[model samples]
Target: MKVHERLDQELSKQGKTQAALAEAVGVSSATVSQWRSGTKTPSATNLVKVAGFLGVQPSWLSYGELGGKTKTVDPKQRDAYRRECVWYHRPAPQDAGRELGNAAGFAFHGGLSTFGRETSQNILDEAQPGQPTVEARYTLIEISGSRLNSFLEAIKFDDLKPHLEAAADSRQKVAAVIRRGLSALADDGRLILLRVEDYGAKGLVGPEYDDGNYMAVVRNILDSFKGDNAGGSYGLGKSVMWACSQFGMVLINSTLSVAQDGKREGRYIGRLELPWHRLTAAEAGSPEAYAGPAWFGEKDEARGDVTRSYWGNEALALDTYLARDEDQPGTSFLIVGAYDPDERFQTIEDMHDELVRALAANFWPAMVERAGDDPGMMTALVRSERNGVTIKSDLVDPHSYTPAKARMLRMHRDDLTVDSLEQPGDVVRRRITLEVPKRLSDGAHGSQQHEAVLLVTEADEDDTDANRVAFLRGSHMVIREELVPGLRMGSRTFHAVVLAGLAAGGEPADKAADRFLRAAEPPEHDDWMVTPDVSSSYARGYGTALKNFRIEVRKAIREIVGRPTRDLSDGPDALKELLRINPPTVDTTKRPRVKSAVGKPDAEGRWSLDVRVSLPAREAPWRFSPVLRFGTDSGAAIPVVWEKLVPETRCTVTGDVVVAEAGAREVRFHGTSRADTHPVMASLATALVDVRVYKEASK
Candidate 1:
């Protein structure tokens, strides 16, 4: 393919004037004319940059080759790299036009845009006044419900086989409709977490990230596919998946996503970056800041007369930090690929259970809003016709659990922070109720011990008045300082309370068997079992199991602040918690009750607490609206809310979860309790012995 001929075709396809294309690539019209006339070739380096801007591959532009190379590397590093790329980068190239990074835009059907700078440039002239600046990013975050099912569906070779048989080509050609849907997922993430409209002006809050982590995240999510798994039937989503990534090649888009809910989160598009010699954080005047004028905390800060979306610029009057790294840049898709049951799940049934938990994690409120009052609005990735969808969590928590008792979980504390990253973020605490069946053992579908898994880390994070009032009329919490895992993985001090039902040995014994038991010593009898079979009797038992389980789950969730799982196979705690702390019911008029109980340590390596303390709540309402608020507290109108609480629904977190911890040293936990308590009796029918060290006493 002649480079000049290809260039003209792309210019015509992009509906852009050559002059306009020259301006975007920072090349003179004369240079473009030369390349077009075949008088001269673009330098390899310039070609690469130009290709990126046009959403084409340098390999295609330079060597006229196809099938961008699939990365192969050390598995662990590959997995980590994939997480960063899939969650941070834009979608991968899926078509020939995309592979070429055609600037004229691929022949993608079904959508048209009047807003994007690229689109406008294609329709208008260069640097025209009144033209809006192109966005630095347009990202998407996607999560799947049943990995087995999604993966299975993604690999419908039989269906694809027919298409392949008809054509000599075996390379996949995704239907345009499918591509649009996949694009929608990534688009939703960007729209929710990065894109914003402030006072009639569209804006962005996320970084125009150009890092390894981001690129890998985008690639893993938008590239890889799965073959066979428990519930997966056909691999249709794969077509759109590849198309989504390639779209960015031409549009400067980057996406970040994870295959499994809690499996990974990071940049997907940026992983396409080639490594540089060495880069680090350097002092400003001693040198390394952006060269030009800027603002400290002003909304829509301009960058050298260009106002896209940048927080820091102008380089002076502030402290600076630099980050430098060493390594020849490469990419991987380990975690992103490994998550899809790559021949090691042990059993299909076990894979199903993992899918349930994955779906139930419901952690992305910015992407999809879960409303219990309005079940229709409670969108989750884990949806089924009969039950509903599960959601992935995003809090980046390191908590774990086990079945022990039946109890009510409630709100513990909701703290707010302002000026966190030069700005502030609010902190909230949730206390939830979890149910534990008396018998403790595992099973195919439902295990008695899994009932009490609070899964609070995947619960909600709410927005309220205290945070807004403290910051400015429209403030929301931004996760400025992420709670990183301690050297001892789960060692952070997570303040929580397990409100067990009377059945789990609470003050008031509340039992579920007495109210819904099918027989005596239920765990031993097949009739009383929740997973003993597919018989009518099993279905009957499942009904009773769901009924009792939902009550405790709902109560526990009311305290969680963000979106939750509406239909969880185990406890449904995630969904219930999301419903509880949605802020609509927030009576912020009251002060958050942060109670401290006085305690004294004893010689037996233990401590006892008995002190008078008041956890107070004083209701005082202020502006709770996001953005566009006149400020109930002040007459001056400002940007109402900080973006985090209601962040543009994109996957912002970009990392992997370490292994779940064991023993007292571990901090947050999720699991069923050892004993079940009779709510009516307020005592466990059985005795307990396992103890977790919530904390140690000070000397």
Candidate 2:
């Protein structure tokens, strides 16, 4: 925070005009205007007078120091200050309906890895125009005892405790999760906070509650104010942070690229999502019902008690555990009471690994540097701490995780791709034509052809998730990865990349393709398809064009790597005449075959298993139900029910069927069998698992 920022915020907060402040401080109104504009600083004597008039300490007004301390606010004034300093929105009594939970938060499957992907995309999308690279950091910190107590006091947790407790008693599904979060805090006396910070990017800049990045992220829902070329447009990505939090609360601190209120740093606020609930007059100051969402900031009484972001001081920021290390333009999101709903990341170390893996898998292109001078679009780092002790610190190296794909990206960036591959490490480039249809509103007659670049190379033996074509557009974020279809049996394993739009780096058609593919993306932005936006915007039969475009992409891949069919007629004539050569029989076993399985009994006597299954390539999604059993050497296997099933890669669990994404050759999942369902103790039995393809009963 700066002196001008402090002066401006205090003037608005106190409802005092600049002229009034100047009169009180014995200065001309023009002098005060200069002070507010940051053109001149107040003299020491004038500073004290100005502070006294505003009822704030001179040190705070001058340099954002609180009571002459650097990191601690006055303990006695903590609650009182928060009560008066921060605004908390309660539901209006005359509202027509109640919202149980945030629908946007539920849009994503709550997991740490998913959170990483969404946040990283947001960071990359906000990269500064001329900066070489944007830097993102993920920090997991555990606090307890005094440290935790101070944080709770700073945020005025008491103001929120009654609402959380009331919502928990309501017994809604989201409330049940909140109940467990409260229980864990009481039982362990600790809280885990996940802070995502980015540098070299645009921060939350604009009016506190109007049309700008600030309002788009902090004050509104389903309002993505990003450009057409940005990675995400659904405006739901930020909800992932709230979903990851066990407490449904997230705090924000941003340093704006453009100044707001004559200042550019320490813009801080917090938001809490809870179900609508009522409180008795005894529990709160008055009997009240809330409308499910609340904000933490300076209360604007003039605006129906709505809260707006506050210009935070160093002491306030440090106490809330949101102090940024640098003065760079970016934002930091602190997920209060953060926890992985999937339970895959039980320890900080697990979280560290997941963040790195997720980033490398989804944004390797943005992390790949070109040859000489130019840097990649972004860099990432992950750090973990327990009670202020560093447990792990990793600067993610994208090449280490996705070597083949990263190499291709580097080659593409440097324009080093060859026409065909002749040796190992060679990248082959070709053009796949995409027929982009004219928009329905454009009044155009025909479609335009856009050339999308396709890069392919032989995959390294150790490369994981190889032989898949990654789709990217203007943002260079992977939209989806799928195996190329129509490849001959025994085709060499390879890695492929389809770069369209600006990522293709040439031709005016790039912009047209970018707009087309962007409109085709759903809210998750995971894949491009025939979406409502696409249907309403494009001409008739646009879906067919999209289908053909995908087909052409696959056809190009096959041309690059598919082996030629063998000629049976070349064999001995007598043998060939007698032999019945089947024309490439298709594998009808849609069921995934278990390639490997491992398990162990946990302390609760439940069998925990990690299984990998391989499937035949197909355009349609494969659906299967995993069956768990206890096996014996010479006896019938006993069936067991799974207590939990978590998809690990390229699959999703819906109802009872695990739907593997189309073109997935293999998938991995983790399961824990119900101990109660076991015929005997899990430790005394061998776990057997099978995946059965789901079949619809014939009428």
Candidate 3:
């Protein structure tokens, strides 16, 4: 065999150097050089090693036939050698198209966006010149009855009782004992509640809906890092749910129907993941050594003891009581002792209200308007029973939620419309090409240059206005309403959405878009990553696109503001316009009365006075000035320290004072948005806290 020439050919094919191959084969460079130069032939053992390192059959390297057909060997040894030849030097499978580096492993099917840039480009090109005014209908989504279930006391123990008794072995007795022990526990004895916050407005639980890619997001992490077309590349988003639980864990319940053996079977899977600990360091083969992580459910004995479903497991009865008789397939998450890392909300109610309102702000368009090919008109219901009253907190249409927007909507709809929708005063949509930096050539998905679209709108007048645009890779919004360089449209607040098309020459645009989206976002999907200098081609591409978008926005703003406007201020019309611009404030004199008191014991034996504070949502981001005044039973003013309340949400706070006497403790939160000053100054709203102290604490 001309081994030297063959070695040279394989090296060239793999683009490997002699030194690299030598290191890989655990041989000296000189020996590899000599073998390649035909100066010497390796021994039989080394020859087999050489063939394996080159990912070729030893017989083929020794003789001249593929699959070692020309060589003779023992049948058993031949099969073993073939197996070795196939994988000994083979590298782990990888996607060359992805540039996510450490995040490359999360490119799974049904991940994020398949047609990111392509669809974005189509939308940009196909978007009509005018910004059409769309009408939206507002309604309430009431989620009554029990939306959750307790797993501790509710198990199919009767289904397993007969099996436990009929087991003609010790395994049966052990199973029966476990079942009896678990059955004796109360509902809260070992049970927890899981909250699954689905992305869109409509939670994943509806009759005509399918769980689709969301199921992958709930079930697995780092499983998506495979192909180029994955929707999400960073495996981090899946961990957000797990980390939300105080135990860094959660139990998942999903309904799935499968067809096996020509029979359609309905399956409800309850699964949980918990980290196992070892009491002490023991030898690897020890019977009770520490195991890292284990599934909490029934184990499949035939499959090397892999846990199946938690539902039929005797130790834990983890089936859902929330599943309906007319069952619509969806998912629920049970986070035992759920706690927020941000410390934004003190209780479950506060978190629910904050989340509902935040969702309304971020996805208002998707909820009110039809998002093409996506879930239509989303709704979320956060319901809980408190003090004999079932409180359901739901997101209403923006017109109903924000008072400022509600006022604007009340005006004649025709007056809000401009004669020409795409005219300067109406809206502007521009599709432009961006020049890429010259340094970004090798990593370029297409040519160094790419295309992007910019849209600017001057509709919707809310005083607490943020004029920012969203950066989109495809349909997936990379960055929410953010300001880019040169994007400041002064005085008049506006809304905008921008999209960038990215590409490198080797793959199709859609595939390139997948790589772009994967590399751009971190695992948590909070926002696009800000690590271009330290990241892969994907982040760098976004950086470049962002820079280009800023340039385009500056130009569009200049063109749009250059138009003339009609003067609507003449005598009586001027006064009316002034009143509309500077709205009146709510009268603080007629504040809500809080006469009830509720007290609970604190951990330190000190009585905790729970107060329900009512603060209405604001139309804009403004600081609230809260003034707390305390009065004694004899109508004497008592001094008290006012804690800074987070203006973002309404919450239940614990009052510090143990009032010996109480008449009225007033909290008036005032703001300047509704005032008639230049920057406006008026009392936006007030707050009332229901406090209960050890003594008389009612006001």
Which candidate's TM-score is highest? 2
Residue 548, model 1, lDDT: 56
lDDT of 1 by residue, 1-699 (tens): 566777777777878787665544434466678887877666433454457556675434543331122223345543332222111112222331223222112222212111121111111111112422211111112233443234223222122222222221213232332244235434632211111001111111123323322222232233112211101111112122222222121111111122222222221221121111111233122222121111112222243322221111211100110000111111111111111112233222333334333322221111111111101111111111111221221111101111100000111110111111110011222323323333323221222322222323221122111111000000001101112121131111221222122212222222332222322212211122244322322223454554454444434333332232322343343334555645546432221111111111212212212111111222321111111111122233222211112111111111111121222111121111111221211121111111111122111
lDDT of 3 by residue, 1-699 (tens): 465787778878988788765544434577678878877654333454467567775434543331112223245533332222110011112432211112222222211121111111111222122322111111111111232222322333232222222221223322232233234322333322334422211122112112333234434445432234333444444454444433333454433332223322122233222222222223222333222223333445565435443331211211322222222233344444344444465444665565546544543333322211111223333443232233433323433343222212111111222222222123345555554332342555443445555555443333244455655443332334555344332334455555454311132443454355445555433344444522444334567664554667666654654343223233222244555665457322222222211121222222222222222232321122222322222332332233322111232222433222122222322111111221211111111122222211222
Q: Judged by lDDT against the true structure, how good is candidate 3? A: 0.35
Q: Candidate 2 lDDT, tens digit per residue, 248-303?
A: 89999899999998989988888998888877878766537777788888778788
On a 0 to 1 TM-score scale, where does candidate 3 land against the true structure?
0.44
Judge candidate 2 against the unseen true structure and give its global Cα lDDT, from 0 to 1: 0.76
Worst 10 residues of 1 by lDDT: 469-478
lDDT of each: 0.24, 0.76, 0.35
Q: For residue 694, what is the lDDT in candidate 2?
A: 62
Select the stronger candidate by lDDT from 2 and 3: 2
Q: Please identify model 1 stretches exceeding 4 Å from their true place.
A: 1-240, 243-447, 455-540, 556-699
